[model samples]
Target: MRYFIHLAYDGTAYSGWQVQPGVPTVQEALNTALSNVLRQSVRTQGSGRTDAGVHASHQVAHFEADFPPEMTLDLLRYRLNRALPPDVQVFRIHEVDERANARFSAEARTYEYFVRLRPDPFRRDQALYLDRGRPDVGAMNVAASYLVGQFDFTAFSKVKGAETHYICCLYEAGWHETAEGLVFRIRANRFVRGMVRLVVGTLLDVGRGKLTPLEFQQVLHRQQRIAASGAAPAKGLYLSRVEYPAGIVPAADVREPA
Candidate 1:
């Protein structure tokens, strides 16, 4: 049976989400645990890759297991969790169709970069403390508005594979401020490598008055990475959610049991 696993993890102390040759990775750890539990080699495909030190609140992956017809979702989740590392947790599992793919089938993916003006021990790893002078939230929002809609995001991504184009549809992009910090929310049909980090960095520059909002639009139009903002640290970025088509998988399979 093919099982879809919904999980979340603190990406500290690991290379990234994809399996690497020697360095530890979330996919490697998951494949190891699943392989151990099933007593056979198992591989998984993640919804998307998150960089080192990134975090995910809702990441998805699918794996195949050939078991005696007696396997239950509960049993698989239990065994996988028991064998997996503490930093990564499998929240739930659902039996999915053999044709389902965690990444290709995704409709939308959302990410957030959290920046706090003050230090908080509880959120140190999960958030970035950017006390580099209070930024102008209004200016940041204005610049973020330019990020909405389809555009050549070549200026944002770092690693551009031949198969992956830098053109992505930005469904929603904005910044919100709270008492403690600011959050940059971005939802897109797809993302290019280092897209979010670079966007955050440019927005920060806008807030700091280093870049004007109109100039930010010009940067997007320039279609050059060197023309735009800095890529922020990976720690502040989180894969907040992923959207899939209805009936692709049962809703119960998308999250962990309370």
Candidate 2:
């Protein structure tokens, strides 16, 4: 049977979500633990591949197992956590349909990038610190509004393979200030590599008076990644949530925001 696992991780130590031959990755760790628990070579798939130093509040993965039939849900979770490194944790697991996919089956993904104006000891790894003067939050919001629709995000993504189109439906994107920091939340049907970081970086330029909201729109229309400023630090980006169809069995729901 197929199983889905809800997970969260501190990406500070991982290369990313996908498994690479020599690099330590979240997927690799999970596979190793699952394989060890099932007493067979178990493989899994993740919802998305986040960049190095990026974190996730809610990430999901799927695996298939048929050997060592004695394994139970509680036992698998316990053994997996004990076998996996401290940086990654699996909170819940349930048997899912064979058709479930961690990536293709997802309906929406939400990400948040945080920027802080003050020193935060508790959030050093989760938020970006800007020592400069205050940013124009109003202007930044106006610029973010222009990105809320189906559009080609080539201007905001690293130039990747052309096999798939760069178009995506951005449901929500905006900036807000809190005592903790400036929170930038973006929800979309899909995302291109480096898309979120680039959007946040360029919007920061708008907040700092370097780019007008109209100019930001022009950048999007240009369809060139180099037209944008730069990608924000990977440390501040988080996969906050992933929404799936109602009947599908949900994972642990740990680390992911509601």
**Model 1 RMSD in angstroms:** 2.2
Tens-digit per-residue lDDT, 59-160, candidate 1? 999888897577677887888788889999888788778888899989899998899998899988888897677899998898889989999999887855
RMSD in order of candidates: 2.2, 1.9
Please write out the lDDT profile of model 2 over residues 137-212, one tens digit for every residue. Answer: 9999999999999999999988764428899999999997887768999999999988999999999999999999
**What do the candidate models score in CA lDDT, each in turn?**
0.86, 0.88
Clash list (residue pairs), candidate 1: none
TM-score per model over all chains = 0.94, 0.94
